[model samples]
Target: MGEIKNRLRKDLTAAMKQRDDFAKSTIRMALAAIQYAEVAGDQARNLSEAEEIAIITKEQRSRTESAQTYADAGRPELAEKEAAEADFLTRYLPQPLSQDELVAIVDAQMAATEAELGAKPTMRQMGAVVKAVNEKVAGRADGKTVAGLVKARINS
Candidate 1:
């Protein structure tokens, strides 16, 4: 098993022993997602740390979206639960980039992209710019935020 999967299993056991319902359930759900990802292709295989992080990130995004939908439907209690689940899942993720850090990354990527393309990138090159920035950030920053920054920078 991967380091992350092992750590998650350990944490799940600890949570169960400590009678921490939220932690136990959240970890269980995450493990289930990981397991599903493991067998998701033509053949079963172990997941690398990056793949594990991607699964966890997808899970977090789903919880966040669920929370928003609940809130929009006038269900604050359900929304809070979903939001809390998202927060719990975030513990397994890398520390998120601050706005300043993200902007710095975007700036660096924009420079690289400009150099590669032999000019400042216009909106036409938004895809290339966003792809480069996303690779540099390596999941530390949110996609939408990165895309927004790329769009704004390209436009300016």
Candidate 2:
């Protein structure tokens, strides 16, 4: 938004004036990503709130992955830096879905499928069950985790 961008610009300037390198760099990175989206034409027009949220989500995910890799390489200082940036980015993202919500979605999908199947179905049912639950919980949970949970639910 024009207002948010203006505020970010002011904050970035203040951070630079204060020699707050981390804050300045993180805000610059986020701004660059927003500009890149515009350049790529995906956001040719003014960005919607949802589009901004998606961009922030992407930045947060990248920061999280980078932090994990840094930690795994025994660079705790760098990892902590990445994590702090992630925390900043997270402020712009939607609240993450909880495990309970995810599980309930998965269960609902299974119940609906079982009702259709009338009883026990073949192993092939796994794919359909997973597909259905995944649609219901799309973008909220990790795909691999959902698949594993669906498999375990199907087996039990």
RMSDs, each prediction? Answer: 1.3, 4.1
Candidate 2 C-alpha lDDT tens digits along 123-153 = 6898888777766654456667788878888
Residue pairs clashing, model 1:
none
Local distance difference test, each candidate: 0.92, 0.78
Which candidate leads the pack in TM-score? 1
Show model 2 residue runs off by greater than 4 Å. 1-21, 41-52, 115-135
Displacement of the residue 63 alpha carbon in candidate 2, Å: 1.5
TM-score for each predicted model, relative to the true structure? 0.93, 0.66
Off by over 4 Å in 1: none
